[model samples]
Target: MGRLFMLDVPENTSIVDVARHLDDVTVGRIGPYMVIESGDSVSIDRRSTDVRHAVWYSCVAGIEGWRIAQWDKDALRTEPR
Candidate 1:
Protein backbone atom coordinates (compact mmCIF):
# COMPACT_ATOMS: atom_id res chain seq x y z
CA MET A 1 0.00 0.00 0.00
CA GLY A 2 1.03 3.60 -0.57
CA ARG A 3 0.70 6.34 2.01
CA LEU A 4 0.25 10.11 1.98
CA PHE A 5 0.50 12.38 4.97
CA MET A 6 -1.42 15.59 5.54
CA LEU A 7 -1.11 17.88 8.49
CA ASP A 8 -4.11 18.20 10.80
CA VAL A 9 -5.59 21.61 10.21
CA PRO A 10 -9.00 23.11 9.60
CA GLU A 11 -8.27 23.60 5.92
CA ASN A 12 -7.12 20.03 5.44
CA THR A 13 -10.28 18.32 6.70
CA SER A 14 -11.71 18.12 3.23
CA ILE A 15 -8.63 16.26 2.05
CA VAL A 16 -9.43 13.55 4.57
CA ASP A 17 -13.02 13.41 3.34
CA VAL A 18 -11.88 13.06 -0.24
CA ALA A 19 -9.41 10.34 0.61
CA ARG A 20 -12.09 8.36 2.46
CA HIS A 21 -14.20 8.18 -0.68
CA LEU A 22 -11.60 6.23 -2.62
CA ASP A 23 -11.87 2.46 -2.87
CA ASP A 24 -9.31 0.53 -0.79
CA VAL A 25 -8.13 3.79 0.74
CA THR A 26 -8.13 4.23 4.50
CA VAL A 27 -7.72 7.39 6.57
CA GLY A 28 -6.12 7.54 10.02
CA ARG A 29 -4.16 9.90 12.21
CA ILE A 30 -0.66 9.73 13.60
CA GLY A 31 0.02 12.57 16.01
CA PRO A 32 -0.96 15.50 13.76
CA TYR A 33 -0.69 13.67 10.48
CA MET A 34 -3.68 12.51 8.50
CA VAL A 35 -2.46 9.27 7.00
CA ILE A 36 -4.09 8.03 3.79
CA GLU A 37 -3.33 4.54 2.59
CA SER A 38 -4.30 2.65 -0.53
CA GLY A 39 -3.27 -0.28 -2.68
CA ASP A 40 -3.17 1.68 -5.91
CA SER A 41 -2.66 5.30 -6.76
CA VAL A 42 -4.68 7.76 -4.67
CA SER A 43 -6.10 11.03 -5.89
CA ILE A 44 -8.18 13.92 -4.58
CA ASP A 45 -9.92 16.70 -6.47
CA ARG A 46 -8.99 20.21 -5.41
CA ARG A 47 -12.37 21.71 -6.24
CA SER A 48 -14.16 18.99 -4.26
CA THR A 49 -12.28 19.96 -1.14
CA ASP A 50 -13.27 23.64 -1.41
CA VAL A 51 -10.09 24.72 0.26
CA ARG A 52 -8.50 28.00 -0.69
CA HIS A 53 -5.47 28.00 -2.91
CA ALA A 54 -3.04 28.64 -0.11
CA VAL A 55 -4.34 25.82 2.01
CA TRP A 56 -4.69 23.44 -0.88
CA TYR A 57 -1.16 24.08 -2.06
CA SER A 58 0.32 23.47 1.36
CA CYS A 59 -1.95 20.71 2.53
CA VAL A 60 0.36 17.80 1.98
CA ALA A 61 2.85 17.83 4.81
CA GLY A 62 4.84 14.73 3.94
CA ILE A 63 4.89 11.51 1.95
CA GLU A 64 5.69 7.96 2.92
CA GLY A 65 6.13 5.18 0.38
CA TRP A 66 4.72 7.43 -2.31
CA ARG A 67 5.64 10.14 -4.74
CA ILE A 68 3.63 13.01 -6.13
CA ALA A 69 2.31 11.92 -9.48
CA GLN A 70 0.27 15.05 -10.08
CA TRP A 71 -0.40 18.12 -8.00
CA ASP A 72 -2.15 21.09 -9.52
CA LYS A 73 -5.15 23.35 -9.16
CA ASP A 74 -7.39 20.58 -10.41
CA ALA A 75 -6.14 17.64 -8.36
CA LEU A 76 -3.51 15.87 -6.28
CA ARG A 77 -2.34 12.39 -7.20
CA THR A 78 0.17 10.22 -5.34
CA GLU A 79 1.58 6.91 -6.46
CA PRO A 80 3.79 4.24 -4.98
CA ARG A 81 7.45 5.11 -4.84
Candidate 2:
Protein backbone atom coordinates (compact mmCIF):
# COMPACT_ATOMS: atom_id res chain seq x y z
CA MET A 1 0.00 0.00 0.00
CA GLY A 2 0.98 3.64 -0.47
CA ARG A 3 0.72 6.59 1.85
CA LEU A 4 -0.45 10.14 1.18
CA PHE A 5 -0.10 13.09 3.53
CA MET A 6 -2.15 16.25 3.78
CA LEU A 7 -2.06 19.26 6.07
CA ASP A 8 -4.77 19.76 8.65
CA VAL A 9 -6.31 22.98 7.41
CA PRO A 10 -9.92 24.03 6.97
CA GLU A 11 -9.71 23.58 3.22
CA ASN A 12 -8.22 20.10 3.60
CA THR A 13 -11.04 18.66 5.70
CA SER A 14 -12.81 17.61 2.55
CA ILE A 15 -9.72 15.73 1.49
CA VAL A 16 -9.97 13.56 4.58
CA ASP A 17 -13.67 13.09 3.96
CA VAL A 18 -13.11 12.06 0.36
CA ALA A 19 -10.36 9.66 1.31
CA ARG A 20 -12.68 7.90 3.72
CA HIS A 21 -15.14 7.13 0.94
CA LEU A 22 -12.65 5.06 -0.97
CA ASP A 23 -12.35 1.32 -0.34
CA ASP A 24 -9.12 0.08 1.24
CA VAL A 25 -8.20 3.66 2.10
CA THR A 26 -7.74 4.60 5.73
CA VAL A 27 -7.56 8.16 7.03
CA GLY A 28 -5.74 9.23 10.15
CA ARG A 29 -3.82 12.09 11.66
CA ILE A 30 -0.14 12.62 12.37
CA GLY A 31 0.72 15.85 14.18
CA PRO A 32 -0.85 18.54 11.97
CA TYR A 33 -1.21 16.32 8.93
CA MET A 34 -3.81 13.88 7.71
CA VAL A 35 -2.41 10.54 6.61
CA ILE A 36 -4.05 8.37 3.96
CA GLU A 37 -3.19 4.76 3.28
CA SER A 38 -4.31 2.69 0.33
CA GLY A 39 -3.56 -0.70 -1.16
CA ASP A 40 -3.91 0.58 -4.71
CA SER A 41 -4.22 4.01 -6.25
CA VAL A 42 -5.54 6.85 -4.10
CA SER A 43 -7.61 9.49 -5.81
CA ILE A 44 -9.75 12.40 -4.68
CA ASP A 45 -11.95 14.57 -6.85
CA ARG A 46 -11.17 18.28 -6.63
CA ARG A 47 -14.66 19.50 -7.51
CA SER A 48 -16.35 17.30 -4.91
CA THR A 49 -14.23 18.82 -2.15
CA ASP A 50 -14.86 22.40 -3.24
CA VAL A 51 -11.51 23.59 -1.94
CA ARG A 52 -10.16 26.93 -3.09
CA HIS A 53 -7.32 27.08 -5.57
CA ALA A 54 -4.69 28.13 -3.06
CA VAL A 55 -5.63 25.47 -0.54
CA TRP A 56 -5.97 22.73 -3.12
CA TYR A 57 -2.60 23.60 -4.53
CA SER A 58 -0.88 23.58 -1.13
CA CYS A 59 -2.91 20.97 0.66
CA VAL A 60 -0.26 18.33 0.42
CA ALA A 61 2.36 19.02 3.04
CA GLY A 62 4.51 15.91 2.82
CA ILE A 63 4.82 12.89 0.55
CA GLU A 64 6.27 10.35 2.97
CA GLY A 65 7.31 7.67 0.42
CA TRP A 66 4.74 8.63 -2.19
CA ARG A 67 4.87 11.01 -5.14
CA ILE A 68 2.16 13.08 -6.76
CA ALA A 69 1.19 11.33 -9.95
CA GLN A 70 -1.69 13.68 -10.77
CA TRP A 71 -2.54 16.92 -9.05
CA ASP A 72 -4.53 19.63 -10.73
CA LYS A 73 -7.98 21.21 -11.00
CA ASP A 74 -9.49 17.80 -11.67
CA ALA A 75 -8.05 15.46 -9.02
CA LEU A 76 -5.19 14.36 -6.77
CA ARG A 77 -3.41 11.06 -7.31
CA THR A 78 -0.53 9.71 -5.23
CA GLU A 79 1.59 6.71 -6.02
CA PRO A 80 4.43 4.91 -4.33
CA ARG A 81 7.91 6.20 -5.05
Candidate 3:
Protein backbone atom coordinates (compact mmCIF):
# COMPACT_ATOMS: atom_id res chain seq x y z
CA MET A 1 0.00 0.00 0.00
CA GLY A 2 0.96 3.58 -0.52
CA ARG A 3 -0.06 6.48 1.68
CA LEU A 4 0.34 10.19 1.15
CA PHE A 5 -0.42 12.64 3.90
CA MET A 6 -1.09 16.05 2.45
CA LEU A 7 -1.41 19.07 4.63
CA ASP A 8 -4.96 20.29 5.05
CA VAL A 9 -4.48 23.72 3.57
CA PRO A 10 -6.17 25.89 0.98
CA GLU A 11 -3.36 25.49 -1.52
CA ASN A 12 -3.56 21.72 -1.19
CA THR A 13 -7.31 21.39 -1.55
CA SER A 14 -7.23 20.77 -5.28
CA ILE A 15 -4.61 18.08 -4.95
CA VAL A 16 -6.66 16.31 -2.32
CA ASP A 17 -9.73 16.49 -4.49
CA VAL A 18 -7.89 14.96 -7.43
CA ALA A 19 -6.52 12.20 -5.24
CA ARG A 20 -9.96 11.37 -3.97
CA HIS A 21 -11.14 10.75 -7.51
CA LEU A 22 -8.40 8.32 -8.44
CA ASP A 23 -9.21 4.62 -8.94
CA ASP A 24 -8.82 2.35 -5.93
CA VAL A 25 -7.83 5.29 -3.79
CA THR A 26 -9.26 6.45 -0.49
CA VAL A 27 -9.18 9.84 1.15
CA GLY A 28 -9.51 10.39 4.87
CA ARG A 29 -8.48 12.87 7.55
CA ILE A 30 -6.12 12.81 10.47
CA GLY A 31 -5.98 16.08 12.33
CA PRO A 32 -4.54 18.62 9.88
CA TYR A 33 -3.63 16.04 7.26
CA MET A 34 -5.55 14.60 4.35
CA VAL A 35 -4.60 10.97 4.14
CA ILE A 36 -4.65 9.41 0.67
CA GLU A 37 -4.18 5.67 0.42
CA SER A 38 -4.14 2.99 -2.24
CA GLY A 39 -3.32 -0.67 -2.52
CA ASP A 40 -1.03 -0.09 -5.47
CA SER A 41 0.81 3.04 -6.51
CA VAL A 42 -0.68 6.45 -5.84
CA SER A 43 -0.24 8.78 -8.75
CA ILE A 44 -1.70 12.25 -9.21
CA ASP A 45 -1.36 14.26 -12.37
CA ARG A 46 -0.22 17.79 -11.61
CA ARG A 47 -2.23 19.45 -14.34
CA SER A 48 -5.40 17.75 -13.17
CA THR A 49 -5.07 19.47 -9.83
CA ASP A 50 -4.55 22.88 -11.51
CA VAL A 51 -1.97 23.85 -8.93
CA ARG A 52 0.97 26.10 -9.60
CA HIS A 53 4.56 25.00 -9.15
CA ALA A 54 5.07 26.38 -5.66
CA VAL A 55 1.89 24.92 -4.20
CA TRP A 56 2.38 21.59 -5.94
CA TYR A 57 5.92 21.16 -4.66
CA SER A 58 4.98 22.04 -1.10
CA CYS A 59 1.78 20.06 -0.88
CA VAL A 60 3.10 16.77 0.42
CA ALA A 61 3.04 16.93 4.22
CA GLY A 62 4.32 13.37 4.73
CA ILE A 63 4.26 9.79 3.38
CA GLU A 64 4.25 6.21 4.60
CA GLY A 65 4.71 2.71 3.13
CA TRP A 66 5.89 4.37 -0.02
CA ARG A 67 8.52 6.50 -1.66
CA ILE A 68 8.27 9.25 -4.24
CA ALA A 69 9.16 7.49 -7.46
CA GLN A 70 8.34 10.46 -9.60
CA TRP A 71 7.86 14.17 -8.89
CA ASP A 72 8.11 16.63 -11.71
CA LYS A 73 5.97 19.09 -13.64
CA ASP A 74 3.86 16.24 -14.94
CA ALA A 75 2.90 14.16 -11.93
CA LEU A 76 3.60 12.80 -8.47
CA ARG A 77 3.96 9.01 -8.21
CA THR A 78 4.47 7.05 -5.06
CA GLU A 79 5.31 3.35 -4.90
CA PRO A 80 5.59 0.86 -2.10
CA ARG A 81 8.67 1.28 0.01
Candidate 4:
Protein backbone atom coordinates (compact mmCIF):
# COMPACT_ATOMS: atom_id res chain seq x y z
CA MET A 1 0.00 0.00 0.00
CA GLY A 2 0.99 3.61 -0.50
CA ARG A 3 -0.07 6.70 1.34
CA LEU A 4 0.09 10.36 0.34
CA PHE A 5 -0.43 13.23 2.74
CA MET A 6 -1.38 16.68 1.51
CA LEU A 7 -2.41 19.87 3.19
CA ASP A 8 -6.11 20.68 3.03
CA VAL A 9 -5.64 23.98 1.31
CA PRO A 10 -7.36 25.44 -1.71
CA GLU A 11 -4.42 24.46 -3.87
CA ASN A 12 -4.60 20.84 -2.84
CA THR A 13 -8.34 20.33 -2.82
CA SER A 14 -8.28 19.71 -6.54
CA ILE A 15 -5.51 17.21 -6.06
CA VAL A 16 -7.80 15.31 -3.74
CA ASP A 17 -10.48 15.32 -6.38
CA VAL A 18 -8.16 13.78 -8.90
CA ALA A 19 -7.03 11.16 -6.43
CA ARG A 20 -10.59 10.21 -5.52
CA HIS A 21 -11.43 9.73 -9.15
CA LEU A 22 -9.05 6.78 -9.20
CA ASP A 23 -10.29 3.32 -8.25
CA ASP A 24 -9.50 2.03 -4.75
CA VAL A 25 -8.07 5.34 -3.58
CA THR A 26 -9.09 6.47 -0.10
CA VAL A 27 -9.28 10.01 1.18
CA GLY A 28 -9.10 10.84 4.85
CA ARG A 29 -8.27 13.76 7.08
CA ILE A 30 -6.26 14.51 10.17
CA GLY A 31 -6.59 18.09 11.31
CA PRO A 32 -5.64 20.27 8.37
CA TYR A 33 -4.19 17.39 6.44
CA MET A 34 -5.84 15.52 3.60
CA VAL A 35 -4.68 11.96 3.41
CA ILE A 36 -4.84 9.95 0.20
CA GLU A 37 -3.98 6.29 -0.06
CA SER A 38 -4.10 3.41 -2.48
CA GLY A 39 -3.28 -0.26 -2.56
CA ASP A 40 -0.96 0.06 -5.54
CA SER A 41 -0.16 3.66 -6.45
CA VAL A 42 -1.43 7.19 -5.98
CA SER A 43 -1.32 9.68 -8.82
CA ILE A 44 -3.12 12.80 -9.99
CA ASP A 45 -3.49 14.41 -13.39
CA ARG A 46 -2.27 17.98 -13.20
CA ARG A 47 -4.17 19.29 -16.20
CA SER A 48 -7.46 18.03 -14.80
CA THR A 49 -6.95 19.83 -11.51
CA ASP A 50 -6.83 23.23 -13.25
CA VAL A 51 -4.56 24.65 -10.61
CA ARG A 52 -2.24 27.42 -11.69
CA HIS A 53 1.49 26.90 -11.89
CA ALA A 54 2.22 28.43 -8.51
CA VAL A 55 -0.32 26.29 -6.67
CA TRP A 56 0.56 23.14 -8.57
CA TYR A 57 4.24 23.62 -7.93
CA SER A 58 3.78 23.69 -4.18
CA CYS A 59 0.74 21.63 -3.36
CA VAL A 60 2.02 18.60 -1.53
CA ALA A 61 2.57 19.05 2.19
CA GLY A 62 3.75 15.62 3.22
CA ILE A 63 4.08 11.98 2.19
CA GLU A 64 3.89 8.79 4.20
CA GLY A 65 4.43 5.19 3.18
CA TRP A 66 4.90 6.28 -0.40
CA ARG A 67 7.55 7.77 -2.63
CA ILE A 68 7.23 10.48 -5.24
CA ALA A 69 7.97 8.91 -8.59
CA GLN A 70 7.18 11.90 -10.72
CA TRP A 71 6.30 15.52 -10.08
CA ASP A 72 6.28 17.90 -12.97
CA LYS A 73 3.80 19.91 -15.02
CA ASP A 74 2.05 16.73 -16.03
CA ALA A 75 1.27 14.73 -12.88
CA LEU A 76 2.19 13.61 -9.41
CA ARG A 77 2.90 9.90 -9.20
CA THR A 78 3.58 7.96 -6.02
CA GLU A 79 5.11 4.54 -5.79
CA PRO A 80 4.36 1.77 -3.32
CA ARG A 81 6.17 1.81 -0.03
Of the candidates shown, which would achieve the greatest lDDT relative to the real structure? 3
For residue 27, what is the lDDT in candidate 3?
Answer: 95
Alpha-carbon runs more than 4 Å astray in model 2: none
Better of 1 and 4 by lDDT: 1
Alpha-carbon deviation at 29 in model 3, angstroms: 0.4
**Global lDDT of each candidate:** 0.88, 0.84, 0.92, 0.85
Q: TM-score for every candidate vs. truth?
A: 0.94, 0.88, 0.96, 0.91
Write model 4 residue lDDT over 1-81, tens digit each, in one string. 777778888778987988888999999998889989888876788999999878887888888778899999998998866
Regions of model 1 farther than 4 Å from truth:
none
Candidate 3, superposed: residue stretches over 4 Å from native: none
Off by over 4 Å in 4: none
lDDT of 1 at 78: 86
Candidate 2 residue 60 Cα shift, in angstroms, is 0.2
- What are the clashing pairs of model 4? none
> Of 2 and 3, which scores higher on lDDT?
3
Candidate 2 lDDT, 9-80, residue by residue in tens: 777898789889998998988898888888788888988888888888988877766678999999998877
TM-score of 2: 0.88
The C-alpha RMSD of each candidate to the native structure, in angstroms, is 0.8, 1.2, 0.7, 1.1
By TM-score rank, best first, the candidates go 3, 1, 4, 2
Where's the lowest-lDDT run of ten residues in candidate 2? 59-68
Which candidate gets the maximum TM-score versus the true structure?
3
lDDT of 3 by residue, 1-81 (tens): 778998888999999899899999999999989999999998899999999999999998899999999999999999988
lDDT accuracy of residue 25 in candidate 1: 95
Question: Candidate 1 overall Cα lDDT vs. reference?
Answer: 0.88
